[model samples]
Target chain A: MIDVKSLSKHYGTHHAVDGISFSIGEGEIVGFLGPNGAGKTTTLRVLTCFHPATAGSATVAGYDVFTQSEQVRAQIGYLPESVPMYPEMRVREYLHFRGKLRGMTREQRETSLRGVVERCWLGDVVDRPIGQLSKGFRQRVGLADALLHNPPVLILDEPTVGLDPSQIRETRRLIGELAQQHTVLLSSHILPEVEATCQRIIIINRGRIVASGTPEELRERVAGTSGLIVELKAAWTEIEPALRGLSGVTEVRGTPDGSWTRVALRAAGDQREAVAALAAGRGWPLRELRREIATLEDFFVKIVAGAHEAQTVPVE
Target chain B: MRNTTAIMNRELLSLFCSPVAYIVIAGFLLVTGVLAVFTGSFKPGAPATLRMVFEFTPYALAFIVPAIAMRTISEEYRSGTIEALMTAPVSDAQLVLGKFLASLVFYVIMIATTLVYLMLMMVYGAPDLGASLAAYIGLILVGTMFVALGVLASSLTKNQIVAWMIAAVPLLVFVWFSGWISRAAEGWWREVFRIVNISLHLDQFNRGLIDTEGVVFFLCTAAFFLFLAVKVVESRRWR
Candidate 1:
């Protein structure tokens, strides 16, 4: 339930977020993937109404951010990149204050505070001072505060940063659960976390949207050729020539690990069988040979690198 | 209005939770009490009364109010809590008013603690109760003006120390140099300097004179600074 149209933010000469447009539907989990200084935080800040866009506009829950900011803010919950919390406040007290700030009555605040504490797994430390908690717990408290008002939209920037592996997994699961009820716009540099948690991904670079699609869609679009890495008891001099002579073999490189060779193959169709037979015919012991499925990480690297190349190339 | 009250409550609660409110009140009472006693034995100079308490308050406020307000907006900016606050369902005016009101309340509490001086005057000598009340009213008005200026200073920077310095410098200049400028000027220039001089306006109140002009002047100054603070915060959102 969020719509951003040609949104841009400039700090004098530095453009933090260029003309970027995207819409998120209700109950959909969208991940904003970008490296540092990639405008993810700027975009989220605009949607949350923390910062007004220098040009263009955004609407949340059918309210204009520039004119109807109060209504927009009332409908969206934002957890900024840095979880800003009062260290002196207890977990429950902080949640209560946040709920009141979001326009909840006393009874409503108590009810929502209970739900947030349980949902974010903040029960054990509800009475503890927030500053005394571990980083993981502090992150959870931040999440709890965002969820305190039960807003229909959530804008979380790097929600899983600095958390241990277990906490990260738990946060991912919580986000997945949240998606069933609330529209989530999550920003993160961790590719796997985005892949595991978001149904759609938007990759941004240098204040521009480079690509947007499902994880598999992006992976397939960027991964044009499939290859196999085979570890075998063979020398590069002996296996390189044979694989080169194959019908679909495009390139092959041997690693210094004398027993392994990575072969890049191009074929009109599935070429797994051709490579398998070639390995079988050579009678060279094949230890491992499997088609490499391109991952989100590979797609991200290729897209960002390609954007960098396009920027550097001179135009006529 | 609900949001403003909520914010005001939170700000007041935060002040009490820390030692800030208590320390400010205690320090103010202790200092003013000592000054009142020390000035009492001055051979009955200038009709010794609670006027000295009001006379020293603006100078005291020149330092204490900044300390109370330096963290109002600066701490939020530094800790990144301003992001969350700005995203709440509150307008810029509401936020500014809420913070100003909270600091004003603290200033009142600090001023209220000096009532011991009034009680002592009642016991030792027949100090003019009407004049004493008028002076107390004047002190509150001047204190409100200082609080508003402090809030403006806090809004200009995220660094609390810098905010404190910014707030204190202007106040010190106005209090100390306004008299100097008044002396340096002739007819109209001197009168204008005296009118603009905060301490000069405050002197009328301490003398048991309820000059409506002085009251309006302090209020207008407070409103002007608070308006500037709101504008500063609004401009920051675009940046």
Candidate 2:
């Protein structure tokens, strides 16, 4: 339902999205994983027809984002990253306003309003002014606004941002349910959020796609190693050299934190036991020593380390 | 268009829902009431006419209309709601027109409240219905042009205070230029200044005359500003 060909967007000399091309199939939930300012928002803005591409082209639901923007916008429901809303408006009224803007008739809007309110779990705050609601509720209100017109394509920019853990789970479940009928493309900086909801993941960095595959493929190809985060009270200067030579230790990255120091040690597997033992042997006070989860930073490190032939954009 | 009306409806709802609109309207009523009515601009024995209402209302509207329209587009930009709004199926023209018409309607509502003075005049004396009606039409035309200009200013900045200043500048020029028109004696420059002298044009309307020239000026001024506002809004897609 979405096709992008060498899409490039530049703000003056700065290339926000540089010649990145990717397509999403019908009824597919695609995760756009990238760090903040990775051009993810810029890419989605082009697809939503919020901004014209500086180069190349994109089409959403078979309509050109540049030329046939109204048609493209009609087919796609977008939740912008910031989730801008009319604070003074009630949830139902805001959705109704959005529905009207999408050219839905009064009856259509009312029906869709009812459906989105229930689906987005906005029934409690439906009558409250949006500004009065919590950030989580406001995010749901934005989601409900996007869903009110029932567009076939939904482009959500960090849809789960600012929500509590439980709210995040709810949003994920809702997006999963939506994928059965709607072609979903959601962008996020969090590794687990995207992995949880998206069937296929596109990992982008510095305005280019660095990797694309299933979560399982990502785990097998990259993340085959483990790292430990060791934080302890010690002389910052002596921490790295002291821990860099342990068996299976390949990389030691450390930074000073007052008298305490935090270090990330990349090793073959399960390095927490080794790191704890080293701290004990050296007589450095250990505050916290834990294995690193497969964070985005770790994912990038693995991709950069293993895939020299993968044309990876250097981690700047 | 449906899109245009939808935007306009939202704008009107927002205006009515806020206390600021009521405060501005009340301030307008107070100023116009103090200037034209309760203060004896139209004395008891003074001819039964709404000339005083027409005389000062344009200036009252000049300031009041900007305050009404200052938030029309700028608030959307400030709140970042413009992204959601522009991304909708609505066209730029529809959005601008909707906002333009909303401010004009607010102007009408505020200007219309002064009609109570007209009703009072009619009760005590003989006010010409057709002339008073023509004068009110003149007021509406002035408001339409001012609202269009205010919306254009709103499109120029995300700051409502900046928008208010920008909206007031050309209006200030017109008010000051009205004097320049009176000074220049029968020349092309005078005609140039006269074309821009809204007070002179509105004065013709106050006299129960709706010249094609004045009507065309109001419409053309409104159209020019609204067209610029649309261009300003549409420019965002490029940037």
Candidate 3:
């Protein structure tokens, strides 16, 4: 649904988005992951035709963003980072105006209005002024405005930034539901939100895509191998060597907490059965034993740290 | 064209829904009515006309036009709604023209309220019907030009106060001090200043004369400023 090649946006000496290339297919929910000021929003803006690319080309729904911007704009529903809205207008009034602005006929708008308000859960607040609503409601109102036209592609930047925990979970579920019919390209710095909703993740840093893959793939690639966390009613000195002595255990690090020792260690593979056997055979009170799954947060930290190291190292 | 009309509708709806619009309308009616009575030197048995009101319309609009036009684009730019509007299926020309048309319509409504004064004149004394019609036309023409100027100012900056000053200061100078500037100039300069003077363009229309030159002058000037506004708005992409 969207294709970009060597896209760059420069402001004087600063390259806000520098020669980034990526593509999103139809019915794909792709997460654009990056740190703050990493040019994620800039890339989204360029694709939405809100700003012109300084170099290279991009197309959305088979239309070039710079040359054929009108057609491109008609094909995409955009929710900018700030969630632009008119505070004086009511929710229904705002949606009606947005629908008209997007070139919907009165009849079409009237029909879509009901579906959109229900979809975004804006029924109770539809008659209230936008300025009087809470931040969570306002965010959903922005989402509702985007969904009004039912465009093929939805571009959202930081959709769940300021929502509470429940609101964030709801937004994630909403995005998951939206992925069934629409191509979604959402950007965020929150790693778990991306992990929860996106089919694919593209991590960008310093105006470049550092890594792109599924959550499992990124974990295996950056974290190398998985580990296990074992808590036992034993001292660190005893538990560490015992875990290291197991067949698949390659390394062990342990810390004594109160009356128990928590041992974290890496292994060759499938060390769960072997560790359980070892704990059982040792006759040590096993408080807890679980495999430590590497999360996206860990992968993100490793990728960013590696990128920083690579930048700091000088060529020999 | 449809997009332009939609934008105009949205702008007008937003303007009317605000308390500021009513205040401005009432203020225009009060100021123009008082100025008409005082400047016309109304007294018992004296022939009453809207000549004083027409004479002061240009000056009145110089301040009022900026207040109305200042928020056309500047508010959107400041609030980041311009991003949403520009990203929608609307062109730069459509946005500028839509805003200009909305302001013109609002100003015309304000001018129409002053017709009560004209009715009072008709009941008390005989007024020149043809001259009153000409004055209404002139008021609209000059008001259109000022609206375009105000839009151009709005496009240049995100600050409404700055936009108002950018439009009103130069307009105030042209409406009140152009004659002095025209007199100070010599030979070709004097004629050049007079040709560009707004009051000179208004003189023919106020005197019950509807020449093609006066009509074309205001039309072209309004068009020129609207064109500049389109350019300023389009420049956002480059930035």
Candidate models: Cα lDDT each: 0.83, 0.87, 0.86
**lDDT of model 1, residue A98:** 81
Off by over 4 Å in 3: A225-292, A303-307, A310-316
| Candidate 3 whole-model C-alpha lDDT, 0 to 1 | 0.86
TM-score of chain A of each: 0.85, 0.76, 0.80
Candidate 3 chain B: worst-modelled 10 consecutive residues by lDDT: B40-49
Collision pairs in model 2: none
* Candidate 2 CAPRI grade: medium
Tens digits of lDDT, candidate 3, B29-144: 88887887687535676556676667777777789999999999998999999988888878999999999999999989988998888888787888888998998998899989
Better of 2 and 3 by DockQ: 3
TM-score for the A chain of candidate 2? 0.76
* lDDT digits (tens) for residues A184-268 of candidate 2: 9999988888889999999887788888877887766555567788898887678877787778889888888888888887888
Model 2 TM-score, 2 decimals? 0.86
lDDT of 2: 0.87
Residue B184 lDDT in model 3?
95
The fnat of each candidate, in order, is 0.80, 0.92, 0.68
Q: Which ten residues in a row have the lowest lDDT in candidate 2 chain B?
A: B176-185
